[model samples]
Each structure stands twice: as C-alpha cells, then as structure tokens.
Target: MANMQWTLLLLIWMGQCCVIDCQLYEFHYINKEKTWTEAQQYCREKHTDLVTVTNMKDIKRLINISPGNWRGAWIGLYGQTDGTRKWHWSLPGVEFNESEKNWNTGEPNDKTGWQNCGIIWKNLKWGDLSCHDHQYFLCYDDKYILINKNKTWEDALIYCRDHHHDLVTITNMDQQRAVQQEAQFASTDYVWMGLSYACTLDLWFWVSDEVVRYKNWALDGPMDDCDMSGAMETKGNHQWCKKDDTEKFNFICST
Candidate 1:
C-alpha cells in the first residue's frame, strides 16, 4: 500500500511539471539565409516552424525580450489566387480572433500580386512582403503573455504609436498568422491599418514611423487627390485604414 501511494504522488508531480513546462514561452532563432520554403523547412527540423502570433499581448512580450535581431522577419500568412489573404493556420479551419490581429495599416495588401509570405517589421506591425526578404523572426507555442489593452483598429494603431512606437508590422509569415488568428474573430470586414501614402513622394508609407520600403500598390490606386482628410482618387494616396470605422466611406476598425 505504501509503495503504491508513493508511486501515485510521483506521477502527479511529473504531470504538474509537464504542464508548467508547456506553459513556458521560449524564443528560437534561425540564422541561415534561404528561400521561404527553405526557411520553413529549417524551422520545422528544429522542432518549430515559422513563427505564429496569437494576440497583441504575445507580440509585445515576444519582441520585448528579443534583442540584437533584424527589423523584419518571416511568418506564415500567404496570398491566394482568390484575391483574399488568409491566415495559414486558418487554412486548417481555425477561427481567427480579432484580439490577435495587430495590423499597422489595418488591411492585408499583396502589392506584387505574388507575395505569398509574411513579415514582421520593426514597429511590430504585420505586412505581406516578399518572401525573398531575409530577416529573423519569432515563434510561439502554448504560452500566455498579456499584451496591450484591446482597442479598435484605429485606436489600436494610435495606441501602438502613443505607447509602443508604431502599429504592429509583420516581418515574417509566422507573425502574420498569429495576428490573423487573434483579430480574425472581430474581422467582419477589412479594417484600417498603419500604412498610408505620401502625397509629395507619391509612395506608400508605414504610418508607424513613415518608413517606406515595400511599395506594392495596385494599378493606379493611390491617386493623390490632395484631399488630406478624404479618400484618394487613385492608388497614389490610397492609404490603408480599418474597414469598420469608415464613417461615411471612412476607415474600418477591427474589435
């Protein structure tokens, strides 16, 4: 009887340890330069795949602890031929949570029409950039880390600026899927993001810090009409905004 009791206690302790271990969030790094396919293979071989975000809180916690890394990195979201951007995880039929989406400019735009990979930027905003762009990324599992308070897509963008520097920009596909999952629930329609246009330069700019690198505008979309407060007549000044908050053809907000 004594031996059996001791064995049962030991089993209970071991089970507790396993639960705790699974809850602990750890960071992984991949330094090899390769195509998106190669990178995904590398991550999978290392007991992980490209990073996947779950919520804004997870993003804040992950970036806060990471140091000495590049600005943009690969994630898991990719483009489809149906003219729709879907989260990779959602490809498995998992519902997206609005709280997980932290788009800097509020919408997913595959400018090149061929971009199938995602990336996270310096300001923690998410975007669908070319998979050829090389950078370090983040990975997440069964860990719970509280992120910034929930706010509307517009409010969220402003919050990122007022507090954390800029709206969340994706550097890789992993981060993209994570954000998509979080914001998916609240996303009834497209929303506004941190991306915008520069009338003088006639190019797209990440509203977070005005950094312009990836220019993937649709055919004659952002036509800068000199309307500072109104919509753009063409693709020149067609800034990205939330789809819900568009008051009379304005921007939309998710969650």
Candidate 2:
C-alpha cells in the first residue's frame, strides 16, 4: 500500500510539472473598428489588456499571428497626463525602461494635436499616430512555447526601438542564432539591425546605448551614393552603409 501511494504521488507531481511547462503564448487579434479606448475595454473584457511585448521573440510572435491590415490595435503605451508627450505602458505603473524605448528618426512627433496614444503601425513599429485611425491590433496571452511574427527590415527596426530596445545586435554565434530564429518569418525580406555608419566613426553602432559588440555585414560593407538628384534624393540616401535611421525598413520591437 505504501509503495502504491508513493507511485501515485510521484505521477501527480510529474503531471503538474508537465502542465506548467506546456503553457504556450498565443497572439490574439482585434478588428480595426475599435477606438483606442474601446479596444482597451474589449481586451479587458477578454481578460487581457493591450499587448505588452518584452523581447524580440515576443514581437515576432505577435506579428506572425497578426495579419497585414491589423495596424490600428492598441498597445500598452499612452500619452502623459499633461499631454507633453511622455509615452508609457498602462500596466501597474512600471517605470519607463529607457533601454526598451526605441524611437525612429525624429519620432514621437505627436503630429496630430490629440496624438497622445501609441499604436503598432502596419510596418510593426510603434508610432504616435492619431488615436482615431481604424486599424487592426494585437493582444497576447501567456501560453506554452514562444512564437514570433514576421516584419520588414524597416518596420522591424522601428518596432524594436519604439517598444523594446533596438534592432537586434548580433554579438556572438549564440545571439545570432537566436535573432535568426526569431526572424525566420522574414525569409524574403531583410530585417534591420542596429548597425549603421551614421556616426563619425563610420562603423556600426547599437541603438540601445551599448557599445558595438558584434557585426555581420554582407561583404564589402554598405555603399552610400547619396547623389540621386531627382525627387528620390529628397526622400533619403540609399546606402549599403550601416545604421542609417532615415532608410525605411522593418524591424523588431520589444519591452
């Protein structure tokens, strides 16, 4: 009798552990019709809030689950009370982690007078667009294994800066492998990286305020011939160079 009871207890413990380990993360979607306020309310009703991504993997997973037009969904950030344009997550008053705040070139403009709220753009980067714009949004619920979504190089980079830290910087083989796995969905498009020649040093730099730890360039470095004289020149330079924020591309964002 004692042996049988011990066996049953062991089985129960193993089962519980398996159940806990099997919890996977899932991406939820809301149509674009809801205003920011309404979308927030809807998420609350569903027992989840607007999504809060904490890492590159999370960003990718959400993008993969979301469709192209689901751009207008609410995220965790909101305008400050004074309306001076300090954005923050709507969770239980978590401090603004500077390391996680990625901004595009002269972003957070709050172009529209009431652009106090933040939302994910079609490109995956967080932007301070007018709150009234109708676009699909994403929500997340913790489950088992992690999943990531696909993004263009420009959008991915912007998303990383606005939500998480910055475009992923590959330091070593391990980090490279991890980012590659997260970016698997972008097999056709190039995912943006923090590397750029924008600085005086003319070398790559990380946007997260960290030193240049690693680099993986496609042979011969980036070439910049910013001499396109036509209307295209006004847009921005076309460069094989590294770290040009002006160059529009998709990127990953995280908390």
Assess each prediction's global lDDT (C-alpha) against the native: 0.45, 0.48
Best TM-score among the predictions, by candidate number: 2
Looking at model 2, residue 226 earns an lDDT score of: 33
Q: Model 2: what TM-score?
A: 0.44
Q: What is the lDDT of candidate 2?
A: 0.48
Off by over 4 Å in 1: 1-22, 90-95, 140-255
lDDT of 1 by residue, 1-255 (tens): 111100000011212234221223344544445566666765566533566655556556565655544466666555555555565641233545566776669546767766667677778888776677665544433221113244444565565555444444322333333344434333233323455545677655555353443333345445553322212111223333312333222122221
Q: Give the residue spans of candidate 2 off by over 4 A.
A: 1-24, 68-72, 81-84, 142-255
Tell me each candidate's TM-score: 0.42, 0.44
10 residues in a row with least lDDT, candidate 1? 3-12
As a whole number from 0 to 100, the lDDT of residue 253 in candidate 1 is 22
